[model samples]
Target: MRMFDVCIIGGGPAGLKAAIAAGSQGLSVVLMDDADHLGGQLVKQTHMFFGSEQQRAGARGVNIAKELVEQVTSLVNVEVVLCTTALGLYDDLVLTYETEGSYRKLSAKKFIVATGASERMLTFPGNDLPGVYGAGAVQTLMNVYGVKPGNRVLMVGAGNIGLIVSYQLLQAGVEVIAIVEGGPSIGGYLVHASKVRRAGVPILTSHTIKEAVGVNCVEGAIVCELDSQWQPKSGTEQRIDADVICLAVGLSPLTDILWQAECEMVFVPELGGNVAYRDSTMCTSKPHIYVAGDVAGVEEASSAMVEGELAGLCAAKSLGVSGAHLTLQITSARSQLEELRSGPVGDKIRAGLLQAHR
Candidate 1:
């Protein structure tokens, strides 16, 4: 069994920040992730981010993850375990995970769970077809592996993932016929929606995909308009020929490890599936364990990193590594995090925060 002052799980924007923050504070930290490499989903992202300059605004997620990895790897107190998936958390905060071909146990004096969210997928009649895939998968194939998911695609969901991916598909020389959104308005920001809109792809509102029409692979997408109650309207169905179908409805946190840890949690749909309600320190109902990033709730990479920094700082403090400095750092981080979680869009998520403490 390996031991550390803190174990930060998940190596995306959140876990990477936690590891860096804790190491900077003189805490021995371990970052465990499932991928063969670092960056997590950020590895699959090629576009720049949008936010205040402090959040690395306009920097590609790839560049941001590069800088983050560079910082963490240079720290003597921080260690990274790649190609490892944390399976469960046991008593004394023992982290059970598999790495390479072996299972290992790691114990931490304090723990920060920063495992991020996974892309949420929708199943249609032909969802099982070969060409039907999640936007994240498309990103993985195209952005990370440099392999095109398809030549022509029909995107379902005009949300950020869908729109941004449609634009990416265009960047990769693939054609996007149209994007469909079930909501009245495009599900993502107009900035992103308009980017693709100007490129000549139509954003269809109040629309739903009835099926991906094909026998083995998606040959086309069959779409229909929805009524006020989201029921399919009669005679509005249409088919747009395509070779691929991308689903980008949204994301939900991967919280199975939290479940195994038996952490007190709540299902707040707006926050993006099950999340632990934490105070400013990001500590969960289990005081020794803290939750941050999308696992705490879905927001954006900009805020998730700040939350992870705070969570790591707080966890180090709890375990007596500069516990006194925690207040100052936490104060600064919380202010920034609130900024990211504020605004009109943030307000909707703020109201969805589960206030019932366990």
Candidate 2:
């Protein structure tokens, strides 16, 4: 058994920020990630972010991850453990994790869960085919592994992920036949949607994939137009030829640890899926267990980073580590969050947060 002042159960944008915040206060911190490297999904994002200079808006996500990793590694009070999977959060506040087939137990005064979210899968005929992939998987293959997903791709969903990945595919020399969305309009930023459009890709709103046609792999897709109620319209089915069918429908919060801890959970479709009910400080119903990033609610990386810092500051303060500097930092993080969640773009997140906090 081992102990620390703080144990952060992820190494993504949120987890890394939390570790920096908590460890800078001279508290012992352990940051664990199942992958061999940190940065989580940030490592796969090649596109420049959108936000203020403080959030590194113009910087590419890969570069941002590198910078955050460098900062974290310099913190002597923080322990970075990779290839470690957190098994459960016990009632006694002890966390069990597995590393290299060995089980270990650790207890912390505060546990910050930035476990993040997984890409949501779409249901359709032949969805289990080999060439069918989630948007994240495609990003990892193309951006991280330097492997093209396919020669031509059919993208489902016009949300940011769908649009961004489509652009990335085009950059990789893969042909993006078209992007189909079940909704009435594109769900991502106009900037992203416009980028794909200028690249000669069509955006089909109120359209959805009805089935994937293939025997062993996705050879093509059958798509159709949708009515106002989102029901498929017969006789509108169109066959599109593509070697790959990518689904970027959405993401759902990974709150397994929260559920294990019995913290309050709510289903907020606007936020993605089931998420932990967290306060402004990112503290969940369970006092010692805090949540940030997608585990709390699905949002952009900028907001996740801010939430992580807020959670870390609050957790450290609860442990008697506080000063004027910490107070100011906390206030700044909250203000950034509010600003990020402002505007029409944040309407869905704002609605989701209202339900979670309720």
Candidate 3:
């Protein structure tokens, strides 16, 4: 069994930032990721991110992820293990993972879980068809693999994923027939909605996909208007001819390790699903274990990186590694996170957080 001062269970923006922060503070850190590439969803994000300069605002996510990976690789105290799946978090902070056809266990004084989140799928009549895929899957295929998702697509959900993906599809020469949302208004930022609209794609609010039509794959889709209660109107059904059905409904935090670790879990619909109850420092109810990124709550990448740095600093401090700047770092990170979680758009997130800590 290998041991370290800190073991981060992901290699995304959050996990990478956590490793960099803790390792810079003189802690032995090891970061693991199941994917061969280090950047999680960041690699597939072609659009520029939002936030201040410190958060790399105006920079593409792929570029941001590349910069983070380069910084982490240059650190002597931090180790990066790719293509490794962390199977479980066992007693005494032991993490069991599978790597290169072998199983290994590592124990750490502090474990930071930044496993992120996965796309939420929808079930319809032909949901199991071959051409049906999550927004992330389509992004990965088009952006990462340099392959097209489909020639024409019908997108479900008008949230960030749905809107951003519709624009991306258009950029890639794919015809986005339209975007259907179950909500009364677009769930994502209006700026994104405007961009998609200018591209000539229609945004249908209070609408949803009733069924996908195809035998072996997605050949078309059925969309309809919904009432205030989200029930479909019978005569409002419209058939759309498309080869792909993309579901960008939402995401759920990947908290399996947290669940297996027996941390305090709370259901926060605003933040996704059941997430680990974390304090401002990102420390869960289990003192030695911490959570960041979407595992704590489904916030944006900017907040995730800040949460990760805070958690890393806290982990290092818990091990007796400290400096005058440590307190300032924690304070700044917390402030940024709070600022991000405020405002009209963050109302639901605030409510969910309050319920989680309660």
Q: Write down the lDDT of every candidate, Cα atoms only.
A: 0.86, 0.93, 0.90
Worst 10 contiguous positions by lDDT, candidate 3: 349-358
Once superposed on the true structure, which residue ranges of model 3 sit more than 4 Å away at CA? Answer: none
Q: Candidate 3's residue-wise lDDT over 69-130, tens digit each?
A: 99999999898999999998876788899999998889999999999998898878989998
Estimate the overall C-alpha local distance difference test score of candidate 2.
0.93
Q: What TM-score, to 2 decimals, does candidate 1 have?
A: 0.97
TM-score of candidate 3 against the unseen true structure: 0.98
Task: For model 2, state the Cα shift of residue 80 in Å.
Answer: 0.5
Q: How big is the positional error of residue 8 in model 1, measured in Å on the Cα after superposition?
A: 1.1
Candidate 1's C-alpha runs over 4 A off are: 323-326, 354-358
- Judging by lDDT against the true structure, name the best candidate: 2
Tens digits of lDDT, candidate 1, 234-332: 999998999999999999988887788788878888888888767767887777688888888888888888888888888877777665466788788
- Give the Å shift of residue 4 in candidate 2: 0.4
Which candidate order results from sorting by TM-score in descending order? 2, 3, 1
Alpha-carbon TM-score of each model against the true structure: 0.97, 0.98, 0.98
Candidate 1: minimum summed lDDT over ten consecutive residues — where?
Answer: 349-358
Clashing pairs in 3: none
